[model samples]
Target: MRTRDTRSVARAMPWFLLVAVVLFALNLRGPIVAIAPVIGQIRDDLGLSAATAGLLTSLPVLCFALATPLAAALIARAGPERAVLISLAGILVGTLIRAQGGFAVAVIGTLVIGIAITVGNVVVPVVVRRDFPASRVGIVTGVYTATLNVGAMLTSLCTAPLAEWLGWRAAITAWAVLLVAAIIIWGQAAGWRRSVLGERVTAPDSSEAPPAHSASYRSLTAWLLMLAFGGQAFSYYGITTWLPTILHEVQGLDDKSAGASSSVFQVLAVVGALGVPVLANRWRPGSVVGLVGTLWLAMPLGLLLAPELWPLWSVVGGAAQGGGITIVFIIIVRMSTSNDQARGMSAFVQGGGYLLASTGPSIVGAVHEASGGWTAPLIVVTASVLVLLIFGITASARVESRHP
Candidate 1:
């Protein structure tokens, strides 16, 4: 009878874990995204240039790349559970600091927020892998990824209206509410079930371990994939930062309306995130990249050719950006011959990609300022998409794995 009761408890734990993860996901992207819709207001009040305004978005991404080693160390020292609580605390402090509303204060607060998020980014996968069985890992990871998009969508859709109601400073800082909720729930889950959530690490299957002769790092294809991922990251972050501004400037929509429309780009990512894997199961991995890459290209092209069709462009770009990131990781794993190489390639791609991503907003904003029109910025986006296709498509073809 005790054995049966224990088995039932074990069965129930994964759902609890998943729920904790979902709440945690809601905080990660939403806090950063909360800035995008209200960026125009921020620029005006702060007396900031477009490039400086762009830094509001890029600064966090830059931290994601530069502070990763620090994040990994924090995770290692604190453990994923404690590290998560620490991350939430940091985000709360940062949000409050950001609310004080000065240029230096904003930058410092954003930097702190970014560093905290990097900790969560590195540790959450460890939490999922440790808590769930192999069969359940994929599903948990998928939910984590999808929920990220949901968080971004909610913030993009709501932040402008929230700003109108409460003013931008209070509005951006309002996201701290999510951090507090995540802390309470995750704190309880970890405190009560520490043993289950921090179960002994599963021993790796020998076949999945890296061989002594790992060579993926030396591959030119690996370098190309890294650059391709850079392009994808560049395109996604650039557009995400500026799309609402562009709409307001070009089509004369109010901030609230422009932000609401931009939400279409973010929300549609749910479809693309889940759809890419399913499509990959039916088509060649490279073929999937090609199709999605074309969709990415169409976004900027559509915007440039017919700004009247901005809605269509947003939808296409939304799904494409989501799938674009997914497929690059898929190809990274596919191109690897062993777990070690795959891990190395992933770190390499992500580290380089984010460094490039950190420049996207500033570069695009500067171009827009220079040209005094959306045409230059759209062309810049179009060129980045072409980079993804050229290198991403080439690297995607090198997939040796039977499944994506």
Candidate 2:
């Protein structure tokens, strides 16, 4: 609440931002990850086809992609603070709508919720960069990544038990409460914003110093980074949506165990998401990122070929993949020369990434329907990773955009 800078709050900004990152991270995966574990049950209850079920589950992600550009426009106009608050509010409302239940309503609700997440996803990095010094960015990003995995882990694990006890709607609605909690904490910390990070807002030498950028998308480096980020996103959202169902249907695991396995994958992913960055940050980001793509290609194959062992392999694989994702964010930070560039880069990667990612689950489902088993879907996953690897190899370089 205090605007004045203090030695204590300055030191505490790292911790406070860490907590805020965790809160924001927690909000992200809960809505979408919660859907996968229960998809089978919902299909049976609602009598959905594989395609319909996939769309039902993937609707939120689709909206996530659709919403990013809009969030960017708003952030460009209104500032990140107002955009995030509005997003959090939308998440709460959407979760409540999903709680009311029935196939159409639930899908619509989740789509809205996903749109809300896009806003959070876009803004949090801006907040981090604005609030933290360069030396600490990796640590904060790693912690934030870990907290997001924690949320994803909880979302995967909690869905069934809560559903069993209170029904599916209640399970779905539970995450909304966490968003409400975040609003309160964020309010307390809003005053800390100015002290946290500096923005390079230069005055024009004349009335107009050629608008910041005529087009934000002109830079090849920016496109490469977005593609790299999208590669990671595509793999992550693909797995989160289909992993539980894959385990249950293909590996002969039960519903409960399948869900637990999915949760385990996410929990282990926390290590990857947090841990990889610690190591990767030391190297040339481009070299490190290519390795990330390689890991993506290898791990999912293991999951498909050896389903029984994936619970263990997933720990290794998920962490590697998760770390790759954290690296993607790190690249976004390192590649940009200025705050405006960083903000623009964030918008580009997230907007394109979510759009690319939104198709993963649905495409996986559609593939499964065509191939008659998980084999085809696994191949598709493998291919997606290869694409990611290619993108990361290009993006990992120390590159910055000349334009916005």
Candidate 3:
């Protein structure tokens, strides 16, 4: 009876872990993206300049860049599970601080939230690599990536309505409920604590040996991944921060309509995030990267040339951006030889990439303010897509050479 019970428990573990991953991912984007739709109100209420408002979005990403490397060290000391729990605590605290209703408080809260999220950004890929079979990496990545976008979509769609009904402060605070639920479920989940402690952990099915700790940081492949990820983040965050405003100012949509349009981008992104990985699993990610890059370019160009087709452009851009992010994470895991190396690569990619990305929103805002239009700002995004294409091709080639 004891042996049978143990076997049954073992069978159920993966599902529990999957649930935990999904819940965790759902918290990753909602809090940040929720601010985008209501940013005009936030700026007006706080008496912020465009640059300062841009900083509101860019600050957390800056934190993601600066603090991601610390995640590996935290994991080393506290184990992944405990480190994640600590991150949740930080999220909880940040949400509460933001809810208190002052611009200074909100900025400080966002910084804290960014620091918390940085840990999850670097650690989740390692968890997937450690827990799942090698063959399942793409699917698992797709699922989590999809879940992450779902959270963003919900925020984009709901934040305006929520703010209208509950006020922005309450709406921002509402996200904390999701985080709290995730924390509760994570604590009760079976096998999570053991897995974190590095005892009785399930080994991946692949035959490769563990990589030396220094290998990922020193390799050319890691640098390529960082650049690819950086390019993607730059484009994604820039669009996300300003898409609603761009629609409102340039495309002549109302604030509500613009917010809804932004949600459409996020909704389509979910499709891309889920679909890209499955396609990449069958085809070469390198080839897919070029296609995705073209889609990213088309979005801004469509907006520039034909603002009338904003809906179509939004969907295409969202899909491409979503797919680009998912593919980069997939490559990060596939290119590494072990979970530790994967963690290291994730840190490097997100740390360096996000630091590079931190400039996107502020730069876009400054350019918009200076040039007095959206054209120049969007051209910047187009350039970023081109960069994404260049590095993505090289990153995919590196993965093919290493894995094949």
Best by TM-score: 3
The local distance difference test score of model 2 is: 0.73
Residue 215, model 3, lDDT: 59
TM-score order of candidates, best first? Answer: 3, 2, 1
lDDT of 1: 0.78
Regions more than 4 Å wrong, model 3? 37-54, 164-166, 190-199, 202-215, 369-372
- By lDDT, the best candidate is 3
Ranking according to lDDT, highest score first: 3, 1, 2
Candidate 3, residue 300: how far the Cα is off, in Å? 1.8
lDDT for residue 401 in candidate 2, whole number 0-100: 25
Residue ranges of candidate 1 with Cα displaced over 4 Å: 37-54, 76-79, 125-139, 160-169, 188-194, 197-222, 244-260, 281-284, 329-346, 368-376, 397-404
In order, how many clashes per candidate? 0, 5, 0
lDDT tens digits, residues 249-291, model 3?
A: 9878998898778778878888788888888878888988988
Per-residue lDDT of model 1, residues 1-404, tens digit only:
96686667667878877899999988888888888778889999999997787777778888877876677667656667788899888888988998796899999999999998877765665566556675554446556767889998788778889999999998988888888889998887786465443343233435556654344457767778878988998998889878988889888889878876667888877777778867766678678888889999989899888877889999988889888877776565455554345445555576677888888887998999999999999999999998999998777765544343
Alpha-carbon error at 382 in model 2, in Å? Answer: 2.2
